[model samples]
Every structure is written in C-alpha cells, then in structure tokens.
Target: MTEFQTQIQAATRIVQTVYGLSVEWQPIPGEVEVVQACIGGREELPIYLTQSGEQTLCICYLWHDDEIEPSRRTELLEAMLDLNIPMPLSAFARVEGYFVVFGALARQSRPEDLAQELAALSENALEALEAFADYLKQ
Candidate 1:
C-alpha cells in the first residue's frame, strides 16, 4: 500500500479507539489516491486527508457558497479571519466552492497525531458552524 493509504488505515483505527468515533473511508470520483474520512455523528463535516512530499492536510468542508447570506459574506470572511489565530490547530480556508477548516502536520506524523488532528478538525467544523450561524441563510 502507498504511504498515505497506510497512514489512513492506521489513523482510522486510532481515531475509532481513542476518540470513540466511527470513520468511513470514501473514494473521490476521479481522484484515485484521495479518500475522505467521514466521522460518525459529524457526517455533515467529512474530513479529507491529503499528503504531499512534505506534509499531510486534514480538511473539513464547512459551508458552500450558496449557503452564505449574500449581504453578510464580507462580515463572515472578516469573522473567519479574526477567529483563525484563536482557533487551535485549525484555520479557515476556501477550497473551490466551499469554505473549510483545516489543519496540517508533517507527512511522517504518527498515527496518534493524525487521529488528534481528525478530532480537532471535527470539533472545529462544528464550532465554525456555530460561530458563523448568523452569516448563513436560515
């Protein structure tokens, strides 16, 4: 198996055992090497893990463009920026049509570390939704 695949497997086990969370591996339609981990109870915020030569990324999609209130877009962006630094181990980002919260670690990080990242990203996703609720369409 590829290094990332190995990492994903190990991390999935750790996340389940350590955090008491279920993890489902999903394949992206066209991306052969990319898989997403859907955490139980937080299925709305699936975490996508990707690896490069130097680092691994853990990202959770938070909201889509159409989900945001048109007039509050700027304010939402500003709030995200303000919260970025205060948030632990995660930061806000825009990926194509979605807004996301993500964290990164060394490519060689331990499975425990990866599990921790998954937990943090999951928590951050929920917090982001709560924090930005006013800027979203009801």
Candidate 2:
C-alpha cells in the first residue's frame, strides 16, 4: 500500500489502542477520508479525523456553536476568541455549524504523540465548554 494509506491505518490502530476508543471510517464521495471516534469513558464526546492532505491528518472536537442563540452571537464569538489566547497545541475553529478545537498531526506521527494530542484536545475541549457557559452568563 501507499505511504498515506499505511499511515492512516497506523493512526487508526494507535488511537484505538491508546485511547481505548473505536474509530469508524466514513469516506465521502470526492472528499478526503474521514474517521469518527467517540471518546471519554462514557463516550461523551465525538472527535472527527480527516486527512488534511497527503501528509497531515486533522483531529477535531466540537467546541461550541455561536449561532445557537442569535442574540449572543457577537458575545459568544468574542468569548471564543478570548479563550483561544492561552490555549496550547489546539486552536478553536468555526466549522460548518459549530466551533471546534482542532490540531493537525503528521501522517506518520508516533502513536504516543497522537495519544498526547488526543488527550490534550479532549481535556481542553472540556475546559472550553465550561468557559463558554461562563461566557454566556456575561
């Protein structure tokens, strides 16, 4: 198999083994391959992984949705930007309908590195949710 394919498979295995998480691959027509993993002990969060290109894979977890309540949109966005300031490794991204905390990894990245990224992403995402709740109150 090609290097990209090999790397993808290796990543899948590493995530499963390290996180005790199962990955479901879902490939869309004419798009890069995508995989979904439900993390947390109770499967509380869903993380989406997709190949960013031939050599990078993007790992993303839903952070928040600024459009949920139109009245607070501006405030919510500002809060999100504020939360982004001190964050390390991952950054907040506004995806199609939600804000996501995302980071990219080299296609051939080590399993431990992938695990660290996933752990950091998951932990920070949880913090962001709490921060968003506080932001909405302001």
Candidate 3:
C-alpha cells in the first residue's frame, strides 16, 4: 500500500474509535481516496487527501442549497467572514452553492490529531448553522 493509503487507514481508525463514527472509504482508481462520515447528526463530511505535492488532508462540511435568499447573501457572507477571523485550524469557504467549513492536516498528522481536526471542523460548522439559523429558517 502507498503512504497515503496507510494514513487513510489510520484516519479511519481514529474517526471510528475516538469519534464513535463510521467511515465509508471511497477509493477512486488513480486518484485520492475520500472518507465519508456523518458529523453533527445531519451533515455529511468528506475527508479528502490531496493528490498534489502538498500531501495535505482536508475535512470539509458543506451546506448546499439553492434557496439562499439574495437579500441574505451578503449577510451570510459577512457572518462567515466574521466567524473565520478568530477560528483556529479551519476556515469558511463558499463553493458553488455550498457554505463550507474545512480543516487541513499534514500528511504526517497523528491519529489523535486527525480526530481533533475532524471534531473542530464539525463544531465550527454546527456553530455557523446555529448562528445563522434565524436567517436560514424554512
């Protein structure tokens, strides 16, 4: 197995053991593997190990919806930026129609550290959702 494969296994173990979460490893031929798991009860988080030279793994939480109001778009964007300012180890990103919070880990990160990163990312995403719950009400 390759170094990344070994690290992936370690990460899976960490998520399962420490977080009490199950991981579904989806390996694409000739590409990096993605580990999928549900965090914060309703959100599915995707953990990706970049195939580029950086050898970094990123855990991302995405809230995708086309229903975001145009009037609230600027408010949401500003809120995300405000939350990102003091956040440690993670940041908010907007991709397509999704609002994302992601944390990156080095290829050599320990299993414990991986677990911590995942937890941090999950908490941040949850907080963001709660912070904007009023604006996001259906």
Candidate 4:
C-alpha cells in the first residue's frame, strides 16, 4: 500500500472506533483534500478530518449518501480531536451522479484566508466566515 493508503487504513480505524462511523478511503486524482466516498452511491454522510500528525497531516474522509454535511463533518472531526471548534465548508454536489467533490475551505491554518478567498458568501457560509473572523478577532 502507498503511504497515504496506510494513512487511510490507520485513519479509518481510528475514526470508526472513536466517532462511531465506518469510513472507506479512496484516492482521487489531482488535488489532495482527502475526502470520503459512499459505497455504491449510498448516502452515508461524508466526514473529512484534518489533523496534524508527525510533520504533515492525516486528513481522513468518511462519506454519507445523505450527503456529507459540512457542519456535521466539522463537528465529527472536532469531536474526535476534542477541539473547541473547527473550520467549516459547504457540502458537495454530484455533477454526474457518479461522484461528488467536497468544497475545501483552506489548506490548514489561518482560517480567515479561506473566508477571504471565498470573496462573497451565502448566509451559512457567511456565518462560518463571521465565526472565523471572530476567532481571528480574539
């Protein structure tokens, strides 16, 4: 298995036992956001976790056919880490029904940068941006 494949194995085990979710990891072409995918297009509610491990990160993905709700995604991840709060992003939509790509908020660090990049906002996204701003404000 590739190193990332190993990470997926470890992350999946860790997330499942810890968060009560079973996630299967799949590697997508291009960018590396580490998102979860549902089996056979089941609505399993995807979960993406970004945590700093060793030097880099072990971002974990868990998919839900109900669709991975970003708020729930962030909540699940933060809960596992016991983090106070987490950066959030909007959900993903399947263009062709075969797959859907979750919208990534930012690389990691400086959440405000993500807010800034979005440039505008929907009410919910705006709320998250406002929360991020509040985090920066503190």
Q: TM-score winner among the candidates?
A: 1
Best first by TM-score, ranked:
1, 3, 2, 4
Q: Regarding lDDT, does 2 or 3 come out ahead?
A: 3
Note the Cα lDDT for every prediction shown: 0.89, 0.63, 0.66, 0.36
* Residue 40 miss distance in model 3 (angstroms): 8.2
Candidate 2 per-residue lDDT, tens place, 1-138, comes to 545445545656776887676554444345556655555462556566666544454556454464346677788778878878688767888767667888777766775676667666767777877776644433
Clashing pairs in 2: none
Tell me the lDDT of candidate 4: 0.36
Query: lDDT per residue, candidate 3, 1-138, as tens digits?
Result: 767667766866887788786665555555445555455364455544443555465656456656566678778778778878788778887667677777776667776777777666666766776787655637
Worst 10 residues of 1 by lDDT: 26-35
Model 3 worst lDDT window (10 residues) = 42-51
Model 4 misplacement above 4 A: 30-138
Q: How close is candidate 2 to the true structure, as a TM-score?
A: 0.67
Clashing pairs in 3: none
Ranking by lDDT: 1, 3, 2, 4
Once fitted onto the true fold, the runs of candidate 1 whose alpha carbons sit more than 4 angstroms away are 29-32
Residue-level error in angstroms, candidate 1, position 11? 1.2
Candidate that scores best on lDDT: 1
Candidate 3 overall lDDT versus native: 0.66
